[model samples]
Target: SQQGEEDPQALSIQEGENATMNCSYKTSINNLQWYRQNSGRGLVHLILIRSNEREKHSGRLRVTLDTSKKSSSLLITASRAADTASYFCATAERSDTGRRALTFGSGTRLQVQP
Candidate 1:
């Protein structure tokens, strides 16, 4: 698959600490998006940075993209117990016909202890 893969499948951190995850993809992509899934809850969009962009930030979330390395990183600052969730990186590929749906990575499960 042309999808990305996140390292350190799982992580544990104390509340108020920061959590960082890395993702690596195989093929070229049009855009990359980060999402968070809370237990049984649906995935929520965190940020979307195009291939042309280097880095972007939203609230306490910061994302960086390195197209040359085919990798990306996500950082959540001052995390809370509620911040515990599975984070995924998805790649949007260009299609000859139309825009294709995102291809998700294995994901990184984060646990924040209060």
Candidate 2:
């Protein structure tokens, strides 16, 4: 599969602590994005970092991309119980169809305990 692979498939952390997830891909990418999904809900966009960027932050999320390593990491700071969800990393690449396609990782399940 062209999709990236996420590390630490499951994580448990106390509320107010930080949670980190990693993803590694095999090909060059235009950009990488992080998303969060709650049970029975649709995915929510978290952050996006372009290949030219080393890091980007939004709210409590900090995303870092390393094109040299074809990898990326997402960090959620001061996590709350409400932050419990499955986080996924998706990479945008130019497909043979000449369109940008997104390949997603399996995802990391984060459980924030109160």
Candidate 3:
């Protein structure tokens, strides 16, 4: 499988603190995406950075890619209680099926203390 692996299977932080997560994949990829899942909600796309790009940011979220190292990191600044959720890094790769879909990692469950 081309799925990536995320470190820190779980994290707990105060409401106003920051949270960071890391991901590592085994093979070459076309793109990497960050997703957030809250409770029973479906995964929501947070950001997508192509393999050629190194970094991208959105609102309070920051993502960095290291293609050479086959790794990526996501950082959330001044996290809120609402930010409590699971973060997953998915990778898209070329496939013979003519289209590629993201392969999700195990995810990092983040808990924000109120």
Model 1 C-alpha lDDT per residue in residues 33-58, reported as the tens digit of each score: 99999989999999999989999999
lDDT of 2 by residue, 9-63 (tens): 9999999999999999988888888989999899998888988999998999999
Model 2 / residue 4 / CA error / Å: 1.1
Off by over 4 Å in 2: 95-98
Residue 70 alpha-carbon offset, candidate 1, angstroms: 0.3
Question: How does each model score on TM-score?
Answer: 0.94, 0.93, 0.93
Q: Provide the lDDT at 2 for model 1.
A: 43
Provide the lDDT at 99 for model 2: 70
| Model 1 TM-score on a 0 to 1 scale | 0.94
What are the per-residue Cα lDDT tens digits for candidate 3 across 1-114? 245899889999999899999999987888899999998999999999999999999999999999999999999999999999999999998566737877889999999999
Q: Any idea how many clashes model 1 has? A: 0
Among residues 3 or more apart in sequence or in different chains, the pairs in candidate 1 whose N, CA or C atoms overlap within 3 Å are: none
Pairs with backbone N, CA or C atoms under 3 Å apart (clashes), candidate 3 = none
> In model 3, which runs have C-alpha deviations exceeding 4 angstroms?
95-98
**Could you tell me which 10 consecutive residues in candidate 3 have the lowest summed lDDT?**
93-102
